[model samples]
Target: MTRLPPVRVARAATTVRTAVQGLTRRMVPPPVGVLELVSGLIEANTVYAVAKLGVADALARGPRAAADVAAELGTNPDATYRLMRAAAGYGLLHQDGDRFDLTALGRPLRSDAPDSMRAVVLMIGDPRYQSVWARLPESVTTGTAQAEAVHGVSMWELLDRDADYAATFNEAMTRLTALDWPTVAAAYDFTPFRRIVDVGGGHGRLLASMLGAAPAAEGVLFEQESLLPAAEELLREAGVLSRCRLVGGSFHDRVPDDGDLYVMRRVVHDLDDEQALALLTTVRRDMPAGATLLLLESIVPPGSGPDFAKTLDLDMLLFAGGRERTEQEYAALLDRAGLGMTRVVPTISTISLVEVRPAA
Candidate 1:
């Protein structure tokens, strides 16, 4: 399947939305419905604000007066009461007089929750990304990334220059990996490979999971210098540090040569075709003949019906100058890098395991 550009995807989404609107108009008035749709952007930002304020965390013990919550979070009392009331209206909190309590929907936003969304919310709502998203029209109009247009640099470059933002972004990614790795580990068979290398694997969570799953399989977590400590700590905590090697290097240059299986999760989508091919070429330089490579990512299905990858495609367009690709599109990319697409294994999660090998 040939991947449609972002503009076409947006047009198609609008068409689908229009059809849904027509059906909805049978009951609700069109103006009211459209206004609700328009207000969705504000609602999303409101959630972000509360998430960043750690409102759920503040209310973790019990309900508190809005003034108390505001004092705890170091914000204006009146403003906090207004936010709390709005949040209650949105089902994120429950308001009782001047007090507010966190709802189930809001609990996950707590900083200390096991499945916390605090980092995810913070990273997504980061001013850097928000400013870029504000200029999304530039991406749509110029067919280029909005991050570059707004910040005069790519999102990756911006992160590099801003250490604090980069740390938050990394935390968010780590949280996401934690959410997805269990499904991937359960779905894929990693027993055959003796040595597995995870290229660009940040903090080595997935590699740790893989190593745990395949006990006989020693692993290497290949990433930049800055990420090694966290990766090392994670591997140690997983009790697989002895079996895992932490290598600091850029995939653009080379990957470790000793692995029989190489993996990249959500890595290729960070680069354009040329950059992706270059990274793959570097992998090919080190991968032995017949070694396997797996790309675990969300595979964009054509003619989408409620697929999140379609939304992510626009994010790629705006932030990374890359794209979410269909299966055929991935096969072509693999072919360009002297790798042959062998198969794609669907997991319980939205991601798929795309298997490839060196071309014969």
Candidate 2:
């Protein structure tokens, strides 16, 4: 006699349980109510005054009277106070009588601070990016990205086709990259590799920094041909031009033929599994035996915490048609490319270096 179907068995068990115990409820935090709803929207800073005044940068060291800060920034004292007070209430600053100081939470706003978020803030606060988020509702409705709708093109295409937007975007990345690469250079070991290529290395920012940190390591920076001029200038500015070669190309087609290491920073997440694996396969095939592949990106966690990268993960979904991945997902992607995860290097609270190599 064949056994009853599993669904039928489950339904019979559920019916018996429901008869025994009428109903059940699970606990969860209640949704935000009306007052909280208004509070959330109304609190969004208008004019982003603290950023405008460079208040966070100024107060990073210690507290100062409003008059002094105003004098320092060449602003009216009373206006500065109001802005500072608004910032204080927002937890970016603390107030003591008429004096203003950096709260512990505001330390990340310091331009010189490690993993400083000022650049990120600046990019987000800009009209272009802000506008993109504003249209997110429409993006969700149509399953098309805001950038494409607003600008009449995809972000990647615009970044390549439009010189002005490319310049501004690259400038923002340059600022953030300048702040990050110094730490990455001083921390990561690059002594084993004679040649390393930074594929899809826009403006060659990371390559320049890596070369600066590892003096003996020669480098190649591969970027879109249209972006080559800017990448060359970046290398020149980095003072590593003589030590490196510039290859204007696409990662989808080819990478440097012979390199021990292929470093792609913040590139993998811009692709889905198929595209990501294709890129990985190309890198694996191109890289010499006994080589390393370092994917410098933040690893998405399994469950929700106070994940700062969550916003970017959403941006990946809306903008790139991509999303951040957990370690298990990365393992599968690597396995598909005949590579394996050797180790993970946490560079900071927000970033990690995923080390990969060919399977044995």
Candidate 3:
């Protein structure tokens, strides 16, 4: 049987979820439905608690009594049972008598899982992020990032100061990239480009994958000086180090020029309109007349229906004073920067490749 494309599968799943939600709202009183929505924080924290406690890893081998898991984790037995029971209610685990087993949904919480989300859970649920989110009202009122207000520094500065938090943040980004890179590599043809430059490329994983797809193309990984060492190591492991050059600098100021294709993934979404335009202008200044700029980003759809990009837009506002944009918004931004959006190429992943060229 021919399998449906992932994009179609995702749309189908969203439709089903929307129908189920509608049914649920109809079945419950308005106040009850609203209250249920309010309790989402509890559910999110529960998942974070279990992931932090290594409960999923404890049950990786097989089902085990809650008390046994607590013993293995050196926690209070009764409390562990309650937490595991709560997790079961959330579909992360299955309870049988006093024992609990990790559900398929919970397997990704394990650190060793191929699609592990442990770092993402920990990063979002960390007290630092939570505290910044608590100030969302302030962010909305002032149209500014709350991270600076809460942490007394920008998010990037905070990352530079806290090594542990930086490591977790980097790993979370890498994990997210791992899920989309293969789809992106297959979605676009890179073989025609002799030089590929990945602007703000972190960890160099995406660049490595691109170079692998275009064996004849060399790559330039542009990032902060502090991140170049790690990117170098990853490039070396991918066996593309011989063909890749690691450049250390801020994209806001400049980027290496004369690349046949410039790729920026999830980078523009981290800036407000003015900053984003400035960055695009910097790229445009150096872009060759025939070069292409491929921006891999989640374009906000026209309607107000549920989209991960919408949620991420709010997160960006709260943390970095950035916002996700729609296709028209992107086109407008590119136009102001002397560039024109040629087309948008959809990938199996949430991100789409926005193909652009310098305006005449």
For candidate 2, report its TM-score.
Answer: 0.74
Estimate every model's Cα lDDT from 0 to 1.
Answer: 0.87, 0.75, 0.92
Clashing pairs for predicted structure model 3, backbone only: none
Give the runs in model 1 whose Cα sits over 4 Å from its true position. 1-31
Better of 1 and 3 by lDDT: 3
lDDT of 1 at 39: 89
Q: Which runs in model 3 stand beyond 4 Å of their true positions?
A: 1-6
- Residue 232 shift from truth in candidate 3, angstroms: 1.6
Taking the tens digit of each residue's C-alpha lDDT, what string does model 2 give over 1-360? 223334345446655775553322112223534455456533444224566468777886699998889998999999889888877887878899999898777777677876566666656666666677777788678765668877788878877787665666776676667665644654478877788888888888888878876788899988888878888988998799998898987899788887788898888988868889999998888877788899977788666443546767778767776667888889999999999999877544355789999888
lDDT of 1 by residue, 1-360 (tens): 233334345556666886886687657777888898888888888889998888888999989999998888899999989988998999999889999888888888899998898899899887888887787788889888888777788787887788899889989988898888766776688999999999999988889889888999999999999889988998999999999889998888889999999999999987889999998888888899979999999999777355778878888888988888899999999899999999998765668899999998
Candidate 1 weakest lDDT stretch, 10 residues: 1-10
Worst 10 residues of 2 by lDDT: 21-30
What digit string (tens of lDDT, one per residue) describes model 3 on residues 257-345? 86989999999999999999999999999878899999999989887677788889999999988999999999999999999999998
